[model samples]
Target: MSPRKKIVQAAFEKKKLNGVVARVGLVLDISGSMRNLYLNGTVQEVVERILAVASKFDDNQTLDVWIYDNEFSRLPSVKENGIENYVAKQILNNETLHKFGRNNEPLVMEDVIRKYTKEEPSTQPAFIVFINDGGVVKPTKKVIVESSTLPIFWQFVGIGNSDFELLRKLDEMEGRFVDNANFFHLDDISAISDENLYDHLLHEFPEWLQAVKSKGLVL
Candidate 1:
């Protein structure tokens, strides 16, 4: 098996996310600053790793992929095999990061809220893997506070050497009804071990499950 596939399988066997999260959303950042990461295949690798993680959560073994810079667009649902090609096409497409403009992390969360509450509500708790490499600036604090009662968790992963000020703030942010977000720093994510990666990736999830259940966020 490929190293990526092995990581995925190992996560399923050791982590045992089965019956935990009912859905997985892999949110990718396509800002200009993120261009290198996407081009260098770091983002694709992360997608593959997350796809592996998602497989353990959802029965369909697929992930709802969303890309954003200042704006958000939901691409097609992707499985492990198609991740590389799917990302390649997006990166090599006419709409380059320069055209996409700023990196608005809040817009992605806004889309997530609209999708779940109005567009399609699911009682099953969702695990959102939000990837970015810089600071956030979208008044996401209010969004997280409002969505605190909803059945979803945001696991923010920071890539590259950029200063993730907003992510750090979010990690330490308070006043929410429940703790629904966690952050992980991956300066060079490609070099990280799958075991260590998965460990931190899923560290706070069980507590989130208990918290959400106590609040009746998921059924």
Candidate 2:
């Protein structure tokens, strides 16, 4: 097994998520402010790391990918087999895809909801890893609240030192059937070790899974 897969598996075992199954999705912020991160290969590294989690969590070992600014593009799903140079080939080289623009979290978020809840519809839960540098809008709260009852958990990660007030307050947000989201800030994601990163990523997921299952959100 690849080193990342081993780390992810070890994290799963530590979290007691050995037998859990879920569809994995990655939402990358392609807003104008995020241009540097993309150009510097930070975004590519993010894809590779998340793909490691997907390889273990999803039955098909595939991760559905989406990049968003003001608009969003649902790029092809990525699998373990062709993970190398994925961001460069599937994203940077693709002329048809959307790149840096403005931040519009709700637009892409709704489409993610549509995919797991409507288009593909699965008995397994959907685990969405949302990455952003900042500039979160208020409408994002509405989307998270509305989607709370569904079998989806949003793990929002803020990269860099920017104003993430709204995302930071997700844990306190109310009026949801269940708490369906988590937020963590990392000034520099690449600096973190894989083991620590995996631990942070999977931190709140197991509790969310237990809550959702008890409420019959997932069978």
Predicted model with the maximum TM-score: 2
Q: By summed lDDT, which 10 consecutive residues of candidate 2 come out lowest? A: 79-88
Q: Estimate the lDDT of model 2.
A: 0.92
* Cα lDDT, all candidates: 0.78, 0.92
Task: Kindly list the per-residue Cα lDDT of model 1 for residues 1-219, writing each as its tens digit.
Answer: 767657656665565554565688988888888777777878777887888777778878888888888787877788766766667775557463333468877778888877766787888888898888776775867777788888888888888888877677765777888999898788888899888888888877777888888888886
How high is each candidate's TM-score? 0.88, 0.98
Cα lDDT tens digits, model 2, 9-80, are 899999999989999999999888888888889888999999999989999999999999889999899987
Q: In model 1, how large is the Cα lDDT of residue 11? A: 63
Indicate which candidate wins on lDDT: 2
RMSD of 1: 2.4
Q: How well does candidate 2 match the true structure in TM-score terms?
A: 0.98
